[model samples]
Target: MRNVTDRIFQGAISVFIRKGLQATTQEVAKEAGVAEVTLYRRYSTKENLFITVIKNVLEKKFDSHVLEIAKENETEVFLMNIIEDRLEILSKNYDLVKMLLSESLRGNLANEINLPDIIFSSLKKGLEYHFELKNQTVDIDFCARQLGGIFLSYVVLPNAQPFNKLTLQEKKDIARKHAKAVLATI
Candidate 1:
């Protein structure tokens, strides 16, 4: 059962990134090597499956790690770690990010599935928790927005080499630089 769900999620991700919201359940099912009826029975509709797949991806890829890092590190170290980790993940999943962003810009995705909102909110939550634990008071909303902007700029802006293609030192340098700038500002 878990294997089938994993296959379906993987297939949904591929097809959704390729076709955006226009992707059909049949294509997803075919990509997953499952019957169309199976997908329909499980998801009820393409939108349901899309939302589920996206939430699963975000939860699995982004949220948990950010919270964990927040709990375990100081402010600067947390910022650098989150930035580097997110850059690598976003770079590797560039196509999916682009697709989701494009769809979002076109007002095709639901409010709950708004990718930018979700990312920034997750960052805000992490920052808030970290600051609270340390009894440090900062403009958490601004910080979260700044961090989100940094992440989105890397994803949307043109670069000579993608984040995933950069050497380890280069990645760390980039993260360090951005983290310092953010700290300096706030």
Candidate 2:
């Protein structure tokens, strides 16, 4: 059952990335090697399936990492982990991210699946958790916006060297630099 659902999600992602919100359930069913009825039976509608797939993807690819990193003792380490993990995930899923962003901008997706909002919320929650653990208070909203801005900038702006193409060490270096600056601010 889980395997079948995974296949459907993967198929949905592939089709959605290629065709954005215009893709059909029939296409997704074909891609997943499942009958069209299977998709409808499970998700009921294309919009529901899209929302499920995207939420699952974001939780798996981004949110879980943030939650885990929020447990770090040091703010700098937490910032570094969040920055590095998010940049890598966002860079690797660049196409899907861009498609979602475009659809979001066009008002085609639900607010629950809005990529930027989710990212910002996840970052904000992670920061709040970290600070609460330390019994420290800071401008969590401002810090989340700053971090979210950095992530979104990478999505829409061109970089000299694409993040995915950079070596692990290079990625770490970038994360460290950004972490230091963010730490200084908050």
Candidate 3:
């Protein structure tokens, strides 16, 4: 059951990224190597399938892979790790993130899914806790949102001017600058 679900999820992510919400269930079924009726049986609606992809696959991947931070890590180290992880994931999953952002902006998904809120809440919580541990009195939520904006800028304007042409080292430098920007608020 899990294997079937995973394949469906994998198929959905790829198809959605390639075709947006306009992607057909038949396409997803073919991508998953399952019948169209199986998709309907499992997901019920296109929106349901999209929400599942975001929640189960995209959000899960971000939490486990990108947002995992050690309690024992130093604050600066934590910041760098997070920024690096975010940038790497965003760079690698550029098309998917772009598609999700478009879906979010166009309000295509059902309102209840709220992908942005689901993805960012963890970052906000982590930042809030990290600040407390460091005895920092910064506005935790604002800082978290600001960092999110930094990531969003890259996603939205990846090909904007010199930013698009930055080498990997330059990208890391930008991440470092973002870390410093957050710390400067303290």
Candidate 4:
């Protein structure tokens, strides 16, 4: 049962990433190597299937323990960890995030499905908490905006190598640089 559901979930992700919400259940069924009835049994409608896929993707990309780790660690260490984690998630899901970004820019996706808001809110809150703990006077919202912009510009540099394809050293260097920049602003 679990395997079947996993297949459907992966299939839905693949198809939706390729076709967006316009993908049909029949396409997903074929992609999953399952019957259409199997998909229907679990996800009554295409919208339901898409909702599940999006939810699962977000849950997977956003680490539940990230904020906890941020709260427990030193400010610089937490910023580095957050940078690395955010970059990794964005790199892994570049296509999905890119597609969602384009759609959201067109005012098609609401706040619920807006990937940028979902991804950055956690980081912003974590930064805010860290600043509060240290009694720093920094504006966390502006810091988050700057950090997000830097990370994103590097991640999606057109005509350049994709972030995920970068060497591990390169990623670490970028994360370290991001951490330094944030720290300097404080």
lDDT of 4 by residue, 44-109 (tens): 988788877787788667745666756755777888778877777777788888777666677766
Best by TM-score: 1
Arrange candidates, best lDDT first.
Answer: 2, 1, 4, 3
| lDDT values for all models | 0.88, 0.89, 0.75, 0.78
lDDT of 3 by residue, 67-156 (tens): 346353577677766776766676677888788778878978776556567657767767766766777676867877777887777777
Off by over 4 Å in 4: 135-137
Quote each prediction's TM-score: 0.94, 0.92, 0.84, 0.84
lDDT of 1 by residue, 31-103 (tens): 9989999998998999999999998897667776677888855788888888988889899989999999999
What lDDT does candidate 4 reach at residue 178? Answer: 86
The sequence of per-residue lDDT tens digits that candidate 2 reaches over residues 83-149 is 9888888999999999998998898999778787778878888899999998998999989888887
- Which regions in candidate 3 have their CA more than 4 angstroms from the true location? 65-73, 159-171
Order candidates by TM-score, high to low.
Answer: 1, 2, 3, 4
lDDT of 2 at 67: 68
Model 4 is weakest, by summed lDDT over 10 consecutive residues, at 63-72
What lDDT would candidate 4 get against the real structure? 0.78
